[model samples]
Target chain A: MQLSPSLSALVEALRCLPGIGPKSAQRIAFHLLERDRSGGTQLGQSLLNAMDKIGHCESCRTFSETPVCDICSNIKRQDTGLLCVVESPSDVLAIEQTGQYQGLYFVLMGHLSPLDGIGPNEIGMDVLERTLANGNINEVILATNPTVEGEATAHFIGEMCHQHNVTASRIAHGMPVGGELELVDGMTLMHAFSGRKAI
Target chain B: MQLSPSLSALVEALRCLPGIGPKSAQRIAFHLLERDRSGGTQLGQSLLNAMDKIGHCESCRTFSETPVCDICSNIKRQDTGLLCVVESPSDVLAIEQTGQYQGLYFVLMGHLSPLDGIGPNEIGMDVLERTLANGNINEVILATNPTVEGEATAHFIGEMCHQHNVTASRIAHGMPVGGELELVDGMTLMHAFSGRKAI
Candidate 1:
């Protein structure tokens, strides 16, 4: 199984992506070489293109070609006066798929985990404060994930928003759609019960 | 929730690699931004570097930076006289992992699938024949996989080797080690029984 340095290098490069283990990387590299040469070529080109052309949007920390992302540049979206906060651009897409939430967004780019050495500043909390200080937003949504670090980050952001005199609220947490009562996890069940409101 | 054109392009680009579905692609893209900026930068660089540097080896059809592959360049390997013919370079690696074979290789790069327009020439059978016709080799082991197309390609190669007056033989077909008798498929069990030797 002595592969050349270049072949091994490509496999290693692919392994840098999340969830692509060694075996899978080898399989993929081999499959790409054998089956879809054009696709493999396109993938390599696209990777370079994205890295060279894309940068963080100054306003929301989202990936973009310009200084500001498309959402921040659009005049129609500017009037929403509401901003949703998320951990990543992918989460933005997931929420958008629901066809709800017509407001703008702020991407944290990461969650806070002190043990892992991730801090508030590392995730651009200062930029968020600056956005809130602009005084145009009517409300700020603390949409960080429900994990412990995510909750801690949400609380920290809420406190910061209070200093700027902006109302801050956490997104609702409860059972997922199509989730069964018997199979629901304890924390989710508790959240669902606690958050229940009269019809 | 709306992503910019560049962000969308990055996501789509990532999905081109095998086993990388849309969700995983987005996760990888975001994780790059959040966890390891340098690693992401390196990945982007490597993609371009590999694309610009790597191509198919003229001799074995494996990905190589040179006209002939490193394996083909090894003087020690050239003398082994045994030639293992496989469906792909990956198969060569798989057999090499066994640490038993000391031989050269001829990679078909794919099977003979006429429906898909892949024929003998497309899979580099001419290269294999010319390499064999040099008369330095005595044995050609048909190490193609056990699939239908693999079998047909192996048979076809066997016929070609016979026409060139070279010793041609198929690799062993048998039950895998640690395999249960009950779990073994009928075809495999029959082959194992038929191929059994005297004690």
Candidate 2:
């Protein structure tokens, strides 16, 4: 049976969200109708509130309630003369999961893609350069993903950091720990061998 | 990585939606933050709007924006003196896809499960009886799936309908189309044999 207009509109609207196809959208729409008004309200209010209240931190480009993020404002964190650059806030999360680094972050929010007309200026590379010029950071870790586009973006940023006299290093790209050698690709094998450390 | 309070709350709120497992919730939550705020806002708002505005049709117990759903309201439908009863709206969708049936629907929303505290009253069987007291319907098809609980529910509802002087019939359960007889369970084979048509 066809859903009512309101329910149909709701289902269509839900289809806009990532990974929610038409069927899933209809299921969610009907489920909302069947139950969970409070949850639905919370989600709606949160979306509007987040959109209206949250903005990028001036320094880190990470989401913040204020002009500066909590991490940027914290005085306890080491001013370790080291900065790690990444493309998205999710990347910051991935790095934070390791808990191995104590350093500042710079989020690009997007990668540099020349064919798609995305450039250094579009992705806030100029702001990054200015941040580097103003800060006392002597080392920068280019922790962008090892994909072709990510690598190109990292290389461009590393060159800019070099011009500013900062020691920049690209993050390693190799087979995951515990991965079988047979499963590892050739390019990864090459990098693993070339970057191997003597015990 | 740990999300901030706002982000974490958004993700937690999303968990209330059906079919959204923890992993899918996490992915969707991050995806919303990463891309398409307009789409996310629209989705969240629609969810709230649907939950706030939509309700059950008094007649069919199906979701509707009005007192009676479109299917129940339509005068064009051959009040064919037949009622196809189902456990859920999804079942209605499945039946509607066949395009062979042109009868009215009565959604029970769930089956009778005594162990789980679900009984005829819980599934609106009492309300169904009251509705059927009008004697508008001739045949009541018990289209519940052929699970143990479904069979029990069908039997109970069938008896109730029979008492009301309405003819009731349980839907056939057998090896599905494209299904192998060898792979069919013994209970299903038994059901198939019992429900077999006389050639």
How well does candidate 1 match the true structure in TM-score terms? 0.90
Q: What residue runs in model 2 are displaced by over 4 Å at the alpha carbon?
A: A35-37, B19-23
| Clash list (residue pairs), candidate 1 | none
Q: Root-mean-square deviation of each candidate, in angstroms?
A: 2.4, 2.0
DockQ of 2: 0.59
Candidate 1 per-residue C-alpha lDDT over B134-157 given as tens digits, one digit per residue, 9 for 90 to 100: 998899999989999999999999
Tens-digit per-residue lDDT, A1-199, candidate 1: 5676666777787777777789888887777666666676666666666667778889999777899877788777778888888988777778779978778889887798888888989899889888998998888888989998889988998998899998889999998999899999899899999999899
Among all candidates shown, the one with the greatest DockQ: 2
lDDT of 2 by residue, B1-199 (tens): 4566677777777787787877667677667776777777777677667777888888888887899887877765537878888988888888988988888889988888888898777898877897678888889999987778888888888898978999998787877889889999998888788888889
Best by lDDT: 1
Q: Give TM-score values for chain A, per-prediction.
A: 0.93, 0.94
